[model samples]
Target: MASATVDSGGIGRASLFLASGTIVSRILGFVKLIVLAGMIGAYGDSADAFSIANQLPNTVYVIVAGGILTAVLVPQIVRASQHADGGTAYINKLLTLALLILTITTVVAVALAPLITGFIGLNLSSDQLALAIAFAYWCLPQMFFYGLYTLLGEVLNARKSFGPFTWVPVLNNVVAIAGLVVFAIMFGADPTGSRSAGEVTPAMVAVLAGSATLGVVAQALVLFYFWRRIGLRFRPDFHFRGVGLRATGRMAGWTFGMLLLTTGAGIAETQVATLATGQASVFVLATAWLIFMLPHSVITVSVATAYFTRMSEHAALAKFDLVKTDASSAIRGTTLLIVLASAVIAVCAYPFAAVFVSPFDQIVGIGNVILAFIVGLVPFCVLFVLQRTFYALGDTRTPFFFTLFQVVLILLGVLGCTQLPVEWIAVGIAGVITVSGVLQAALAAVLLRRRLGGLDGRRMLQSLVKYLTAAILPVLLGLSLVWLLGGTQQGGFAVSGRFGAIVSMIAVGLVMASSYFGMLLLMRSAELQAFLTPLRARLRR
Candidate 1:
């Protein structure tokens, strides 16, 4: 049997679990968008208002997530696991502290909803700003529950319960979708975004934002079940003296600072995007971002997440070679798929956008944003791996500098975007972010290389070149199929309706995958065989 160090099988299985869950979650997420767009319409005042409000919690969650879930929790927990008491004492203390912070943060966020709304939606009209504040009052409470989910989920992830972390989001989406259906039944649909901020009623606010919060509550609470199954119990431990939490705090402090910089940049992006609020700005950017995240979430995140725990373990033991090996493997594996995904998705951008919104201009709006965002997809994944590699090595300060570097770039680029046409503002914001991501990833890789002594650069470059070469034909084929279906033309089959868009996207995706796979097969790519090898083994068994 292969040594556990070389046991790609375990990571592959974990990746499969993470990917499968992410795939379902993202699909439901798209469905939720479809329902949301149907109810409020994309690019409408109400949609942008709600989008701004809803995104507030996510922004807050990302802030909380930047430190604990991403940087501090796993490495610390992996270290604590070797304690004589099995780390229960550390877990209890950490959980108690995280929840306390979350509760305080949530209350404060809810109280300052108006202030938060004003800041994020600085340039909105009074009516729209008022609507966003109203929704934020209801929606910002999700900040606590979102933190709750991450706090618990990260603990589970530290314990290697990866499934529930990714799977529970499906429940969140399902509950939210059910709420959308009932909301539509009660209030009627507005898929064309005909409703303006002034037209929204209190009852509408209660149901829509309320249900969204409820979904987050459910998502956070359900993790306790998995927590129990894994034989972990939680108690409120307040004696925070000596369980090694000081070090955790030190790690989280740097991560928090880094994420604050990132959040500032996000705030800048939102403020800039809001300049063209009525013309595919805020809501369009939100929608386009969700589309852009699907492939990253499913492939890059799944693979990177699986590798993270392993890296943490190896790093705790000062095993840099294994960490280097895992990092390279993760980067190469994710890049291979991301390259293909980026190419195909960019080609099918219009059709994919058509599935969410019907208006030709809106489809084009979202499609253009997709193209802008997807250009950075490969680097985005690379950064994901590189950052985690740093975190795995228990170094948060370095990641902060690189993140700060990107944030500065983003802020400057977003300011420049304000001079562009209103219709192009969202696309410009996305393009700026993509460019910043590419630059950040490069800086991170260089930093990581200096620290790790090397990152298998020569082989990684060769594989990257190979993957790009292989994707050329598939990209051309996807573009041709898009043209054949007239994806860019209004009322064409690919953009005519939701049904046609789905069919066209599916057909085009299959053709592209086949061509890409054929190319890889001819080259005998290790990445391709590694993907197939597990499935082939399962079949034989």
Candidate 2:
């Protein structure tokens, strides 16, 4: 495998491209969620029903798009590039095999909608199950399209053409949002979550779930143009002689196990969450998870994704030291921002929830859940880098062991959560999740350190200590400002109205950002410069 030369700032510029698209895509994503919440109340049974069903596509898709594609495809494609045909026949065969799997999976999943719905939403009442099953039928097809998008888009990344992969999600959001608007006009709003399963019509499901599915279709199909530009032609190559599933399965075996473990934990969480249905349960958990992922997606994901290619290149050349350096830098660099973002999100949680749901108790419910999830931001980000680093090193077995360990702990803890009072159940589950994340990260660090003989652990620890110190003043100031606006109190200035929440959140966030960055600058934090150095080098270039 050939290693491409990419200077420091080059990765930073690449991150900028990724982050810019993520920012827009996330904004639209939030918009879509807000609309969905308005359509069905955030804590309502109807909301839980839809959220539960809707999650199936994403859960199945993550197992495919997020896990297997990266685990198997990119390296496979990169290796195939050595052939005289430039990997065309290999890619076509691989693509055909991939689509075939996705198609079968989608069909089977749709056929088993009721059982799948029951598995995740374990405690849903009969009515909720009925409605969720209906939505599942329409939404399950997204598994195929998401896999398509991942297949086409990841090949582009392997080819060093990365723009379309990031940009296409904006279209998905736009299309979904438009469909939501039409659904509102036809079906009317149900912000109170009072819409019963019986009230749901075929038209309602079509406009709602159908729009969501169509968005993914658009996202996947749009990649064909980019594929053509990269000099690839589409053909349904059914000849699967040398390109056999056994080989691919062998390669993806550990990752597939990791995926099942990860989803098992999620199913446990979702089932436990269902116990709090019509309270601060399923829908709130989903919303809070979405919000929790925002900073990670924008900062950690963007930065690490940029660094992954470089690390893989180094790993391919057997440059373990450079791979170690990239992984270390990614963890530290992302954490420097993550700690501050965590502070802001913690302080602004109520107002943030107010952006989506209107009820004061519901706003507080989401806020509490966010606080619970935000506690593990650092560890979560750390684990992300380590997992991707393992992938880059072509070792999925380690991730599986660590992931298996965490999922077991999480399942045990979730079992404990069922005993909590209803109001506290969601928070308990979130806390369990956060704790598992922290422990998993520590385990992953030890393993990677052993494998690489040390991942600059001492320096990384010092950076973490310095970042925690820098975040203290910002967190304090953010808390003080939030208290002033009564962010936690129902009918208070920040939570009284959406506009007020927006204004208060922006004000407090700015103050926190200024104080946090200023403290980092005064401390002469090298971790902070990890991000800046790249952009500065890129600008000069």
lDDT of each: 0.90, 0.86
Model 2 residue runs over 4 Å out of place are 1-9, 64-66, 241-247, 533-541
Reference-based TM-score of each model: 0.98, 0.95
Model 1 Cα lDDT, one tens digit per residue, 62-166: 787535566889889999999999899999998898888888888888888899899999999999999999999989888888888888888888888888889
TM-score attained by model 2: 0.95
Q: Give the alpha carbon lDDT tens digit for every residue of 1-541 in model 2.
A: 1112235657766777777888999999999998998897897777888888888997987775458888777666766676788778888988888898888888888889888897887788888888889999999999998999999987887776667788889999999999999999987999888888778887898889999999999999999998887677889899877644465566688888899889888988999999998789988998999989999999898888778877877787789999999998898888888888888999899999898888888888889999999999889999999998998887888999999999999999999999999999999999999999999999999999999998999899999999889889988998898888988787889988778889998999899999998998899997677656756887999
Q: Residue 350 in candidate 1 has what lDDT?
A: 97
